[model samples]
Target: MPTEGVTGANKGIGYEIVKALCQRYNGHVYLTARNAIKGNAAACKLRKLGLYPIFHQLDIGDEESIKKFRDYITKHEGGIDLLFNNAGVSFNECTQAYAKEAENVINVNYFGTLHAVEILGPILRYGARIINTSSFFGHLSNIPSSSLRNRLAARSLTVDGLCHLMNEYLSDVRNGVHVTKGWGDSPYTVSKVGVAALTIVLQRMFDNDPEKRQISVNSVHPGYTQTDLTGNMGTYTAEEGARSALFAGLDAEGLRGQFVWDNLAIIDWYAATPPKSF
Candidate 1:
């Protein structure tokens, strides 16, 4: 089974991930969104295309909503095979007007993703694949500011540390000090950086233990897909973007915790400057 969130998935990469999984995987797939209407609409569209993806209402930001989805999955599907953390938000143009960019973006993209993982971690089957939808913008090399780069590259980082840093960045943004102080450029960047960092940290954590030995967790850049998160100005289509995610989800054997794009591996930031495409 598969769990997809932020089902406003009306028409974008989220929808495309749903479509791609249906076409590729024969197991049960859960097409989830915060809105029931939108979730069903997207599922119905897939149904018309001869794919039978199930619709469930889920809000990654809400603990209750996440629990409800988890319970539904446990009762119906027993457990999940793949958990794709694809729900994200950005306030590029709008947050600038209100100066709430960091707050808004981190709440959805960072915290929301973690919340889903927290709720679903216990229910994931052995050998289950977890795909975190990160971005190239999340790369640390993109942040040229030295002070901010150092903060973003803090050592021995954990999910709690990452969450704390994101909150600190949000506070800076709201106080109108982050931009002037060079903490970060935008909430989107800060939140995504946290995501990418969280990806590597989680990889190390997941790979270290023998009990949690069957899980493979990884992150990927969908490679500039045309989606609402990008304001529809991306060069690639949602289907193209879902390619790497699907690769991570279904075919990623003996390859856990690797960040990828275009079906290839990405070089780490310490190894190079201003990372090139994988």
Candidate 2:
């Protein structure tokens, strides 16, 4: 049987994604969260609804926690058929200094997600599907630096090069010159841009692996969903936001290495301009 799993699924779009997977995916669905209490609670809620979802504690920010989960999945399920890198954080209205916020945001949203993929990716079954939950805010247009944009859009970009760029951003933030160095003001936006770039990089790596070429990897913008991440200010509900991700996870074929929008349409992240209102 196929096995699917979602990270950071204790609440919001992550929770809704797990719920939908339990309903539609013909396999065991693992609902993971950093908090065991909340994870189990969410699993119980699903059980009450006549759906079976196994709960696992996963804190993407910690490599040890990720390894434990990876070992468990490897041992119990043998391998994962579908995986979602959904755990992330943002400080939209924070009063903290930009430098501090940047560190925290990038740590969880970019590095944390990257760590999860690095460990679990090896255990992904052939023809598996992987979805990286990115955002429209991550569009390349958000970064005003022409040179940086060119570097990021380059097809030759490597995973190591991408990591170097993210670390450089953090360094600039530490030196209090990120803005002058052409980095964006929103750390959340920049970190997500890293996520989007990582998606393409991962796809390239998969393409090089003869056995893994069938695994489709794509990044997606889950729309402006009303969830804790948005402080409930977004237009779409969490359930509504999960549709695009669900579509990509279950049915997207020949759609590899693309950035999909909430409408389920693929957009050129490098050339496409954000809506005027965005």
Which candidate number has the best TM-score?
A: 2
Q: List model 2 lDDT by residue over 213-246, tens digit each.
A: 9888889899898998888988799999998889
RMSD of each: 2.4, 1.4
Model 1 TM-score is: 0.90
Model 2 clash pairs are none
Clashes of 2: 0
Model 1 Cα lDDT, one tens digit per residue, 1-278? 44433333545777888887777776777788877888889889899999888888888878899999889888887888888888888766743364655576788888888888878878888887778888887777765577767766666777787778777777777787877777656677767767777777777777787867688888777887777777777778888888777777776677666677664565474433645553
> What's the true lDDT of residue 241 in model 2?
90
Alpha-carbon runs more than 4 Å astray in model 2: 275-278
Superposition error at 112 for model 2 (Å): 1.1
Scored by lDDT, the top model is: 2
Error of 1 at 38 (Å): 1.1
Model 1 regions lying over 4 Å from their true place:
1-10, 95-97, 269-272
